[model samples]
Target chain A: MRTLLTGNYAVAEAVKLSRAKVIAAYPITPQTTIVEKLAEMVEKGELDAEFIRVESEHSALAAVYGAAIAGRRAFTATSSHGLLYMYEMVWWVANARVPLVMAMVTRTIGPPWNIHTDHTDLLTMRDSGWIISMAENVQEAFDLTIQGFRISEEVDLPFTVGLDAFQLSHTAEVVEVPDQQEVDEWLPERRQSYKVLPGNAVTIGNIGPNEYTAKLRYAMAKAIEDSRKVIEKADNSFGEKFGRKYGGLVEEYRLEGAEYVVVMAGAWCGDAKDAIDRLRDEGLPIGMMKIRYFRPFPKEEIKRLEGKEVLVVDRAFSMGYMGIFGMEVSSVIGDVTNVIAGIGGVDVGVEDFEAMFRKFASRKLQRLEWWPREVFS
Target chain B: MLTEVMILSFGGQGGVTAARILALAAVNEGMFAQAIPQFGAERRGSLVRSYLRLSDQPIRRHSSIKKADVLAIFAEKILKIVEVREFLRDGGITVLNAKHGIAEKSYCVDAAGIALSLNLVAAGWPIVNTAMAGAMAKPLEISIESVINAINSTFSGELARINARAAEIAYREVKKCQAGSST
Candidate 1:
């Protein structure tokens, strides 16, 4: 059914449709509404699930991790500080190879105290063994979330679906929710590779010798790398079932024969596409490469841009280095223009992108620049 | 065509809800719409701004509206406090929740008076959002039936009926004015 929903609410709806067995989350701005709606559903008997109210974000993920170990489909959501608070548990969930889903409403980590959108929070987990995917709009948020469960379980890895803090979280748009029966058929019951039963004796996360630990880490590294095909398969299956598929891993918009390509992720890609369309109308050879899955980093897709004049727009900076995504893209595509903008949720509109592409096409932009300039100055 | 709408009101006046209702109504009318509430640490009675975009095609731009094609002012006095004129595009239609029309190419509805008559009071303040949403339909180029359905879906039973009634009255009683002359 087509209904109006915010990105947060859309994720919650997907969780309900996925028949998540347990939901434990500590409420934070942007992310609060997601769990709030789930809690309401659980309360009203609309969804049959245990709405676990934990004291902190740490306990929230830990509870979900525990639930997942017991072979129950589980979910947990958190934002900036809440995510940081659950940092240790993040590694624990990933290393344990628990199949669970987390909705990460990306926000800026604060010193001046902000509750706004930024990619830094989610990017910080790039090396943490979790499958990370970013959604560009509310419908994609819903699609990626439902896909997260199947993809995670298929790879026996945890998956995190990210949407911009307020830009996507609070913004409401039309989302076509699939029927529960269809979703149930698409996402079958959880099949656990290993479970922590009461009668079984198994120790997870036990201290091991250096070589053993290194080997386990290597296995995890390989699993995430292998998950690339699983992610693509999940997206294709979802598209086949629901008639909506966001080009697997990375969605390229008007990149054919383009001279300048803007590569980025998150909600702003919608605005970027709008700007790109206008630029295309003016006959400018510019397009956008939206990174749908941030990790395992979509290396193959990034490699496709090897010969293009790429401009990487990163909402998260890597302090003393370049933008986190910029660094990654540059490492693959050689030295391309890396511009950091929209940090702390400062609005980057169509006009801003239009001007940036214009400057980029004219070769008037620097190799590394911070939007609004004063942000770094 | 894309019609950008800016809804300006104080926090607690249901500005965000108004945006949602407008967007929902647009969707019900078979158009794509997006409702974006300006994000900030806002408190009650402080200024609040929300945006709505109704388009024949999917809305891909998620940024806050820079220039609005339709400006809906929930409270008339906000015009004094904020330079709202800068945000409205030239020749854009203004929908004012006022007793009298104040601008050319504008529509006015006494939303507060309509709300109070309908006893739609929340937190001791008149609930003028639905009524204003009703007043905006004609200017927004959306059918009043869609607005009524949206209000009905957003509320329940008696509340929905009263709110829909308020919108109906506003739709019928809204005054279209030209250069300060109310019609």
Candidate 2:
């Protein structure tokens, strides 16, 4: 339906339609209202899900894990410190391939104690075996939530849908909410566990030999790798079902016949899109490629942006001067020439896009200057 | 031709709801619109920003409206938050929820009074966004019925009727403001 909704609410609706039976979340900025709205849904009998008001993110994911193992679809959400607190569970999520869907309102880590949008939180969890996707706007936020459920369940891996905290979480955008019946139709009832404990009581988190362990580990890797195709198929099916086609794993705008492109995830892409429109008005051939599905690291998918001057905007700095996405993009470009402009900020404004575009237009590697290293020091 | 209007306001005030009504009205006019929330708005006593990205074209990125054709401020206190003015395009309107009046440059209104007269007392507070939206709509040639339809879509049951009425009253208030100034 054409009801207007926020990115957070869109996620909540997807969670409801994903047939998740448990929702465990703690109140955090940007992501607080998502759970709050879910609680209201459960309270009003709008959703049959169990809304677990956990005291901490650690317990929140733990609660979700238990629910998932009990063979019911499960969910949880966190941001910044909350994700850090639950960092330990990330391994569990990956190792278990829990098929849970989480919405992380990506926020900057503290010390300065900021409550704004950034990618550091989600980037930190990039190595987690979850199928990750960052929303470019509310539509993707809504669409990705549905896709996350499908991909995670199909691959039997958990997925984290990233939205720049405060940015998309709070930003209202025209999100085409699918009919509940359509969502229900698209998202089949996910079997929460491999098998129920009908006296068969097989062990989860089972210990194994190195060879056995390796195969299991690769299963997690395989699922993560498999998520790209799964996402593509889901998006294709979602489009067929809902009349909204979100360009599978990555959505490109005006990229054909363009020379310069800037990359970003989450709502920052919105500002980038407008900037592209404005710049295009001025006759700039610049374009934007939004990597919606972040985790299965669609290097081949990003190969389409190859020869163009690429500037990967990493809101969260990787250990090396590049984020996992920027690194992977650069790696995929693989000796192909492109300037990497690494910039970090909470919920980038139009000025940031303008700066990046100017840098790209000139073909300069503005990394050392654009990065926020002085603060990190 | 997507017209995205981002209103930055504080909680307790109706920034999100106001954006919804405006965007909703735009939809009634047959435009595709979406309202998304942002920083400073989720917590009580904090500044909030709700953005309406509308276009004849389908919106692609879920980014904050960097340049607003109209900037609606629901809280007088939050006027300085995040350089909302920077997002204003040339000749765009900036509406503030201020008491008395703003001199120099601004589209000002005491939206509370409009709600009171409309008997939507609960819809009052952060009064300026609605009034500003109400006032700006006419100049932009957006229909009042569109605004009414938007308010109706978001507000459930009785409040739907209430906010729609408030939107109408707000429209007249803006009209009166325009009249008092020019004629």
TM-score of each: 0.98, 0.85
Query: Native-contact fraction for each model?
Result: 0.80, 0.60
Top DockQ prediction, candidate number: 1
> Which residue runs of candidate 1 sit more than 4 Å off their true CA positions?
A374-377, B100-102, B179-183
Q: Which ten residues in a row have the lowest lDDT in candidate 1 chain A?
A: A368-377
The residue-by-residue lDDT of candidate 1 on A1-377, one tens digit each, is 88899999999999999999999999899799999999999999999999899999999999999899989999999999999999999999998888999999999899878999999999889889999999999999999889999999988899999999888999999989989999999999998877897889888888888998899889999999899889888888888999998888899899998988999999999889999999999999888899999888888888998878999999999999999999999888789898989989899998999888888899887999998666568
- Write one digit per residue (lDDT tens) for candidate 2, span B61-158: 55456677767666555644565557678767666555422323356566666665655544344344455567656545578888877666666888
Global lDDT scores for all candidate models: 0.90, 0.71
Tens digit of lDDT per residue, candidate 2, span A58-127? Answer: 9999989888877788888889999999989977977877778889988778878877776777878777
Clashing pairs in 1: none
In the order shown, the chain A TM-scores of the predictions are 0.98, 0.91
How high a TM-score does candidate 2 get? 0.85
